[model samples]
Target: MARYRFRFVACDEGFLRTFAGSAWRGAFGGALKRVVCAMRLRPCEGCPLAGTCIYPHLFEGRQGADPVRLKSLDRIAVPYVFELDDVVPRSFGAGSEVTVTLTLIGDANRRLARSYP
Candidate 1:
């Protein structure tokens, strides 16, 4: 497993609810797809690139093209998680900083490292 920390300084005043995990996850997923989807395929069900695409691997937990194998598994847990501090204030003023920690398990870190670097 590997961990990474990202810091963001608010440019303007904003309010984030306490326990913003869902909000963060939604934003991250959308942004990731936008940045990585090359074929512009909606749903990604039959896209030829799904097996090797980072978007599906990270967001949808899809591994490969084996239909039977994919159907046999009930659920494939996402390979990454978010670690947020409970004590951080939810509301932000201009210049307020927020730190988000992400942990990637197993081959996830290695896969992403190749994509990014």
Candidate 2:
């Protein structure tokens, strides 16, 4: 397991609404998919690379190919989580900054470095 922190500074004026967790998650997921998806399939269903792709494992909660695993367990939890500040402001002006923490659990920490480089 490993934790990483990323900071983003607004180059221009921007508004981040209260309870922006979903927005952040959506943006992160979309960007990650774009970075990792090789086939660029929309649904990602029946793709030959589904078993090995990091996008489905991270975003779609896909399980491994082991058949002995519990049938009742459908999907596993995502291997990463986003930690946001407790008191997020409603908006930001130029030069404003926000810090987001990303924790990679289990195999995710190992895959992250290899996935990109």
Candidate 3:
């Protein structure tokens, strides 16, 4: 397993302060999914390649059969874990910074992190 750390600074103080945890997480997930999904399909069900797509497997997760029927086991195990530092301030100014940690395991660790376009 490997962990990557990222630091981000809010450009606008007013905007940063308004974002709560769930709101910020949704935005973050949307941005990450957009970069990873090459097909850019709004709905996963409409995508022809969804069965073999890496983005859905990692983000949306595998569906269908759950033979074991474990509790809350609707999807396959996720390959990465996200950890946001708990001490982050509720608000930020133009220069305020926050750190995010991602722990990658299994196949996810083998993929290289790179800038798209």
User: What C-alpha lDDT do the candidate models reach, one value each?
Assistant: 0.75, 0.75, 0.60
Candidate 1: worst 10 consecutive residues by lDDT?
66-75
Error of 2 at 44 (Å): 1.3
Residue-wise lDDT of candidate 3 within 22-114, one digit each (tens)? 555566668777876767647776677665555655566553232333436656776677677645446667887777777777654443342
Q: Model 2 clash tally?
A: 0
lDDT of 2 at 106: 82
Candidate 1 clashes between residue pairs 3 or more apart in a chain or in different chains? none
Model 1 misses residue 72 by how many Å? 4.3
RMSD, model 1, all Cα superposed?
Answer: 2.9
Model 1 bad stretches (over 4 Å)? 65-75, 86-89
User: Per-residue alpha-carbon lDDT of model 2 for 1-117, expressed as tens digits?
Assistant: 888888888899977667666677788889988888888656778888876777877788776455245446657888888877635656778998877778888867656776878
